[model samples]
Target chain A: MIELLLTPLHYEYMIKAIVVSGVIGGVCGLLSCFVTLKGWSLMGDALSHAIVPGVAVAYLVGLPFALGAFASGLLAAVVMGVVKSKTRIREDAVIGIVFTTFFAAGVLMISLFPSNISLKTIVLGNILGIADSDIIQMLAISAVALLVLVLKWKDLLLFAFDPNQAQSIGLNTTRLNLMLLILLAATAVAALQAVGAVLVIAMLVTPGATAYQLTDRFGRMMLLACGMGIVTSMLGAYISYFLNGSTGGCIVCLQTLVFLMAFFFAPKYGIVAARRKARRTTDALLISGDAHPVPALRGL
Target chain B: MSHGSTKLNKNDISSEIDLHVNEVTVAYNNGHVALFDTTFDLGAGTICALVGVNGSGKSTLFKTIMGFLTPTRGSVTIGGKPVQVAQKQNMVAYIPQAEDVDWAFPVSVMDVVLMGRYGYMNFLRIPRATDLEIAIESLRRVNMLDYKERQIGELSGGQKKRVFLARALAQRGRIVLLDEPFSGVDVQTEAAIIELLRELRADEHLILVSTHDLGLVPSFCDQVVIINRTVLAAGPTHDTFTQENLARAFGGTLRDLRIDHTDAPDGTSNEFRVLSDDEEPLIFGHDGRLVDHWHPGIDEEESK
Candidate 1:
């Protein structure tokens, strides 16, 4: 272990992976809170997959992958937003339509290229072999995304609860929504480089959802989720390193474990704990004859 | 079809008008008009009930006032400024329809209320101590202080509505717009909410509530607006709740509002009747001097 740590290549890869994963996880976790709250879990997945055409297009045009992915994701988000806003159709239905169409287009684009870079590998990602440049780019994008979200935190929260209220209060809900959708697309693009489209959804949802079970305060939930993200990333990276498996899969597995634990054990909002508490209270009331008074229980 | 043909009842009116929406028209994207050339005035320091048949533009008018919908024609001015400017010009709080929300989202009563102050706080900053204090105060006002830590998903419909009210109260807005605030509330809770509205109005907060509770207007509200695609009439509750106005507001489908009558101790006449005969029949009551019928039958079911 000591020798491995001292080896220049080993040290560099380990450091690079940890830093990149930690930053990506933390940022995605924070954004995921908003996504989950807005019932946009599938939206995140859709946007993630929607980036392939952009990346493929960028790759074909010899441009940066991030730029390509960002553009494609933005296009998908905008299409989704416009369709949902203008139509009587449900938002999920719109999202389903947009993602499938865009993802299929992306697949066709990749097939047209027929390069050594296969669709399966790029779509799923090769997290273990992430280049130093990719790591740097991922961390930078994540940091920028986090900063933007922090700056617009209040606006975002207001938009999530009641967009009309936000608009009435002089917040341009349309502009703000566009800004958030773009940010979400950008974040999806960044996370895709590290975790692939499939697993990025997990990073965006699981930590925030689990954190939600532990706290009601948005600030607390965001902070707790960031912490959960860091832990999951570190543990997943380590597990993959030792088990000789896919890092992205390992990260999602760890996140699943954390979510399961929180689901059963978290206080206040946890399913199992809440049920137990309700049962205990009912039993206590019944034993104390509090519920025995028929009129009291049934009438005003 | 004649203009000003319907005379408003005059028993339940206050003095000054606070919110005046004149000739406002809103159209959906699909070319359907929700509100057309609507005109109504809500009195200051009074609870004004808005009564109309479903899809008759009641919610559209409320949404317009809240700046959620932009009217295609005419104007909506709160206090004095246009509704668009008034949204930020003064303190304005809105309680949306109960069913318009997704309750499964992860949020708490306190969390929802605290969001009211998000307009006042810096974009990036979290709620401060004062914000929290106001949230708590609002919760206390609505008698939902005990449920502050409870998740929104876990709350009953009435509890959720109260939490929404607390949020509006925390906004500290002088003009409040409420959409179907009593839809799923029990009588006790409804009464409690009405009492809170009374107190708020006493403090000179302009209260505009869009509701199906037409009967409560005689006793609880100072004024009423009868709308059906366009404004039928607007005035004191007693003046506006006439049989003619009710007929126009609900269309001719509502008949002979004299279903049940109770003579008051003060010699005032109170009449209760079915406003509509749908699966959920709308029931309303009038204090004889003024005929008002718009009590939401859905609320009665919740109490049972």
Candidate 2:
């Protein structure tokens, strides 16, 4: 088993794919905590899908895809905000309408202007065939995004927990929302390079959700999510070397497995554990209402 | 933690604190006036109850005071500063309703309390030793230090409210706004909260507690501001919180009854009147004085 794992590390391309995937995965995971906390899972999906047109436009114009993708992602967010505000449409409906329209426009552009960029690579991702420039762009974006998130985590956490209180304390909540939106767009663009659009949402949501099931602290959530992201990404790449499968598919499958495991078997928050706890508490011997319904966690 | 020197005295904090709402008027975008010519002046060291019927602009008044809404006609000043200025200076704290909080958030009780010190922190908002001490002390004040490390989601409803009150205490703001703190809490929790408010008043914190619980209004609050789209009356609780003003504020919504006791043993001929507006009834004794404690009359009769 050791020799089999070592065999893939000998190849430069495999090393490249694994390294890039791990770092980008960690960034996506870090961002996933905030995204999930703010209930912006659908927004992640919307932003990632909406970037397709911008990516295609960048490819056609011979410019960096990040710029075009970031712009269009921002536009999608803004359009959703505007539509939700301007009309009486609910936020989820606005998100659905905006993303589908942008995605369709991207498809039309791809069909009209076919080139070296394959629709499959853009949509489903071709992590194994990524280029050198793409690696630098992804790393730079991920590093900066990571720095910002780590530095401002407390404010972000407070804002996510209670916007009214956050606002009352002189925190610029509007600016904070704008900053999170920008970060969301940037992360979506970076993640698009690895898992493509459809799978990026999972990369942006699953790790944090899984972490949420396992821990009761935001700091722990952040660490567990990032660790889950890195391990799964690299392990998925390694497994793909042996199975000769789609790396994105393998990574998503692995993440799904972890989430299901947490969902059903995590000690405190797992469904099975919860049911067991319910069974045990049938008569609730202590009878103190303040006894903490779940097992007591003293906290960190 | 060197709370040694930086800690501010209650006198220093409260002496300069004053909240003045001038002839403020708020109107919605569709040309509906929610509040008109609402004016009230409140100083420190008093607990004020903002009493009003639903849709009588209580929420609008709160929003205006919190700087969430701007009044069309007048201005609100806090301690000689504008509402926004006071907010930026961290002179205001809010203990919001339960519905506004995300209970499942992955923050510990300590973590939530620590957020109260954000304005005093550095750019990164890292809690220092002093902040930690303050947070722990605030939790202790609320009698919740034992549950400091527990996830907020794990707490009971009353515990959750206490944690929030602890956060407001740690905020160290001159003016604290509590929105419907007793809505869904049990009798024990409500009494605990009322006790905490009394302590806050003793500390000279300007507390504005809004509630539909009329019987609770007089127990702890020292001042009262009754409004019906505007200020119907504003003064000391005994002076301003009269039955006449409350009748004007609530109109026909208040349930009133006068049961004259003619067959008393002493034969002094006193009355037993009760008034309710969907909450704890305000009961009057044979001497026609507002009975000071919460007595669920219907339940007491059941027990009898």
Candidate 3:
């Protein structure tokens, strides 16, 4: 078993791939907690896809791809916010409109420029082909983003829970909101190098949602999500090595598997556990000759 | 419709003003007025009730006081300072409606209450021992210290209200604003909140509560402010919360009820029956005094 695990370490490219994918998973997992709590899952999907045009444009203009991705992602977020607040359009509709437009623009740019950048790689990521500089860039962005999220998580939690109360306590909720959006864009840019645009949403949402089913506390939810993220990324990377398949695809599939496990097996909130609890309560009531047959419990 | 038709009773009001709304006017983005030229003053050691019908701008006034909405023409001040400055100084706290929060968010009851100290703590500094002690004391005051570790989502409606009340209490602010604190609460929880408000008033805290429960006003509040789109009357509850003021604030519905009462058989008993469109009629009796007592959902089945 040890030799099998160490087999991948023999290749320099494999080791680099593992490190880059792991870093992406961890940062995205940490952010997933906030996204899940705030019901910003669609926002994450929107921002990830919206950065495609920026990546294409940056490659065209000879600028750093991360910078362009961050700019375009931020612009998309701002536009979405304005549209939701200034008009009567619902948030989901606004997100859908903004992201699809940006994504279409990106596809058009790629076809127009006809560069070495492949549409498949941009849509589905190329973890094994990441250069040393790309690894370094990913590490820098992930470190800064994770550090800030760890340090100011409480304030962010309070803001997400209740913005009006946070403002009443003298916290600048608007600034906090803008800061969160910026971090989101940056995280999307960082993850873009690993999972590309389309599959990044899975990385940004699944870990926190799975953790949410397993824990009732925010701090514990974050820790569990980070753990799940790292584990899935490493396992997915190893499995993909053997199958000769997409690492991002394997990672997202593994995350879904973990979520399914939690759905049925989590002690407090899982379907199976809830059924067991109901049975036990009913048995106790029957033994005591006090089973009144509650109408609500009948359905459960 | 006359401004200042009801005068402030100096003998009943304290000289020190804890909260002042000076001719505040709030308008929505579409140039529609929500609250027009409203003014009121509240002092320490008093609990004030903001009474108005639906769409009468009660929430707009509270939001303006909390600095969430900027007044178009006037200002809100606390302790002779602007609302923002007072908020920064930790002199004002607001307890929002329960429905405004995302209850499913993962947070402990203790964490929610501890958020009150965020105004006093320095940037990024965790709560100290003193902060925890104050939070615990606040919880104890609301009889919710035992459930401090429970998730907020698991709490009942009354428990949620207590948790929010504890949060406001933990702030130690001299002025606290509550928006519809008793809307969904049970009778026992309402009584508990009333008791807590009395205790806060004894500690010289000024409380402004917006409630649709008009029955609680005479018993629990010392002052009342009636507003339609503007301040109809603002003074001591016993002096300003008259039938005429209520009629003006509530519009023709109240006038119709008064007329229905005059046509009743027991007209000399000073009883008024308010018949809602959907619900049963509620009968209120005034025994030759300003104190009007009525029961909600009482004799409802019989009336039906």
lDDT leader: 2
List the candidates ranked by lDDT, beginning with the highest: 2, 3, 1
Please write out the lDDT profile of model 2 over residues B173-292, one tens digit for every residue: 889999999987889999999998888888777999888999899899989999889999999999988877887888777766555656668988777655677744667878999988
**Using TM-score as the measure, which candidate wins?**
2
CAPRI quality band, candidate 2:
medium
Tell me which residue pairs clash in candidate 3.
Answer: none
Fnat measured on candidate 3:
0.73
Predicted candidate 3 versus true structure: per-residue lDDT over B1-304, tens digit per residue? 2111111122114334478899999999889999999999888999999998889999888889989999999999887889887777667778888888888888899999999878656567488776788899999999999999999989889999999999988887778889999978999999999999999899788999998777778999999999988999999999987766876776554323333233447556445554332343445455544324433322222122
Per-residue CA lDDT of model 1 for B1-304, tens digit only, reads 2111111111013233377788888998889999888887665687888888888887778788877887899887776777666666435788878777867656678878887777666556477677788789889988899998887878887888889889888876778888888888899888888888999889777888887766666778888888888888888877878866887666655443333334457765655544542454434446444324343332222110
Q: DockQ for all models, in order?
A: 0.51, 0.70, 0.70
Per-prediction fnat: 0.52, 0.79, 0.73
Docking class of 3: medium
| After superposition, candidate 2 runs with Cα above 4 Å error | A1-4, A282-300, B1-14, B265-267, B279-304
User: Chain B TM-score in candidate 1, rounded to 2 decimals?
Assistant: 0.78
TM-score of 3: 0.89
The TM-scores that each candidate's chain B achieves against the reference are 0.78, 0.87, 0.81
